[model samples]
Target: MNFPSFGFGSPWVLLLLLALPLWWVARRRRPPSAIVFSRAGTLAESPRRGQWVPRLLFLVRNLAIAGLVIALARPRSGGRTEESLSDGIDIVIAFDLSSSMLAEDFQPENRLEVARAKIKQFITMRKNDRIGVVAFSGEALTQVPLTTDYPVVLAAVDNLQPGQLEDGTAIGTAIATAANRLRSAPGRSRVIVLLTDGVNNRGAIDPRTAAQAAGQFRIKVYTIGVGSRGLAPVPVGRGLFGLRYENRPVEIDDSLLTDVARMTGGRYFRATNAQALDEITREIDRLERTPARTHTYTRYTELFRWPLGAAVLALFMELGLLAWRAPLL
Candidate 1:
């Protein structure tokens, strides 16, 4: 179980605890004298109470003193408040839903599936940041608005598939759409992560022009070109034989992606496999982080009453025992 902070308010008073052992030694050295009788054997045969009663009374006196000393030290336990100073970055992830993302060169799954998994992992890591999602093919569509609700963003990314929109890469529209979403975000740092497997070939707006617009709006763009450089297997159709795979040349505009990154003062990465894509996302996550500042204050509640009560109870018991054992004066 977790406990609250506890300490003494007047710690110097606790030094009095050192006197406990000395007091015990003093009591031992000056032992009480007993009367001696000629017929001591006969006295032993007589009914007598246990010798431990007197020793218990002595122990109680010492315990009373210890409790009083601890009470004087003013032990306390209590309240703390913490405040964070750093703000979270606003991010929009633009995914290319073009048919090119269907390439199975990434691994056991296609490029889009791997991208979705990695994107979800990235979302999990960024707990404090608000994230949005944009899906693009021939045109761009904002699947999720900028929000701190990560589950919604993850759901949006998971639902993305090839051919959801027209069948052409729209890099420029995707970047422009992402930038527009972040334009009104309150965070000082706004970022867009654009992942594509094909070159821009269908959008009315040029990719460079959109990148310039993102730069003008002070939005950083991290571009990732997904797919192998050479030939990759793509699924053709399901015919008489089970699934059919055909080797197709991988086409990705690295120079254009790099220019987009440069224009927005960000970095471009080429991911040939799932591991490489994960690494790239991790690197981007590292670069975009801003340290959070925190301030903590504590309040204390004094706990002297409990020990004080114990001391009084012990002292009263000792006095009562002494009075009961005393003879009439």
Candidate 2:
């Protein structure tokens, strides 16, 4: 009752279209002709059998084209559906919301901006894994819970703005919050990405203590220190007159970050710029992998009859055209 085929099938069908030109050639007028023959009157007696030859040839040509079109369609028969393995992991981004994160040191965008960009790239590379979000500054906040929807996670990353917290950097609190949400996850591979510019200064919990909690939950934590060494410029001027502001050296405590990573059986990275941050995220992405399962269905429909019929019709047309145009030798 129904038939299925490839949408782009039978491009050769255009060849059968040659019939249009063959018909056109039939309608075209022939110039007046004078022929020298044994008997000129006999020419008229030969009958217009020549016209029938083209008609038969055109039919044969159309049949050939039709056969080619059918062949290209690649018709198949039968259908199947099944479910199989799908692999992925669980990921959470714990971003800093402290005021210092707003400092522009890596060129172009600031530290937070660089972190956001890297997180987005990392999400695209992840597969079969649920993800969550956590943002912290002087305090810690859960932005999103673990879910397979990477789009929602990416949107959360974009909304991370500075000065959300009043204290300072609470690396421990951020890690703790992220690990807590992932502690009871159904997926086995759980990971926390803690990004900050400074050491744990505001939270009651120390960075090491939080990392220990993460480890107890079997959560891997990758700590990242984002920013360059030495002083970076700050815009402290007003109007074209340019008032002027003080310059302060940029500071990052890599030791604490490294210790937190080691405590949780993870790695610590220092990103001085965008490229380093991107590479670090990619490296982590490669490290965590969880399995997933997916379902799929395939269908096919037999097409031999069409091509067989075409071959017969072309043979018949060719025979008919030859017989109809036969001349006396």
Candidate 3:
């Protein structure tokens, strides 16, 4: 399937220009039709016994010349990435686990569920990057070590849920853990994708400090605020028909999320629904590819013109025989 050069790119096709001259030469030596032979018995046999032979040899010569012409142009059957973008990336995925994530604002599935689903997709797309996972509620903890195995990293995502830690949202702690994980990474592009619903309600570390720490390590952190501005329903008590009903108002702190992203020279994304969350994930993916590099190609080709020359000689020699080289007998 792959080749350095195809055989058809040779410049033998240019030999077709000589076809006009060859025709002129054949026509010039044609016997004059007005001349009559003295003896009918001497000119009894004609020289056109096989009309197809000379034409067939001409066809073969033309085909061979065309193949040589293509081969000369060096037609490549396939190409390779001569310059690959070596943007070795090391990433950390930090998720929120506060009780507010249980709010029904996201419908059918809560905020945590939506975040996890998108994270799984994110993991699947990063086949060459080394990724780690961190789960945070009241405190931050590394749920998985940095590795290129996406399945193991995705397994850590499955372990996320509200109340996994204590019962608070320590936004800074999660980022801090991500920073620590990437502190010594040798990758040229180090990044963190932090998803949170509420502000820093618990933990000793401040979000700003974590951002600064991540910046020191040249790590870009993209902060995503999950949830919408609305009063959502919550479960309180069972009704007569075994139906539970309740309501609560949850608010997301956009300022902290925005500051975290801006401090690390990254962008902040706000997702209000599952679809928006999917879009945010796609945007992150779009922003996460390695830089493009210029690719180069060099190849060698060996072409033989002997076959085409032989065909042309055969056709012309046969034509000469029909005209004057052979006796009419």
Q: lDDT winner among the candidates?
A: 1
Q: What lDDT tens digits, residue by residue, belong to model 2 across residues 1-329?
A: 22343332344554554666766576565442344223335457774425445555656766766676566555445644568887867788888877677677767887778888888888878776788899998889999998878899899888988756675888878888998898998777789988888767788888888889889988999988988778865444445675343466767889898898999899999988889998899888777766766567775455656775786779777776567553222
Clashes of each: 0, 12, 13
lDDT of 3 by residue, 1-329 (tens): 23543443444555565775686588569874542333344446654544344455455455545554444444443334377664446889988887677667787887778788988997887656889998888988998878988878887788777667897888888889999999997666788999888778899999999898899888899998888777765545558885364676656788888998999988899998899999888888778766434345655343444544554665566566456433332
Best-fitting candidate, scored by TM-score: 1
Alpha carbon lDDT at 290, candidate 1: 59
Instruction: Rank candidates by lDDT, best first.
Output: 1, 2, 3
Candidate 2's TM-score? 0.62
Better of 1 and 2 by lDDT: 1
Clashes counted in candidate 3 amount to 13
Candidate 2, residue 212: how far the Cα is off, in Å: 1.0
Native-to-model Cα distance after best TM-score fit, residue 227 in candidate 1, in Å: 0.3
| Error at 63, model 2, angstroms | 42
Candidate 2 versus truth, CA RMSD in Å, comes to 12.8
**Residue 78 displacement in candidate 2 (angstroms):** 14
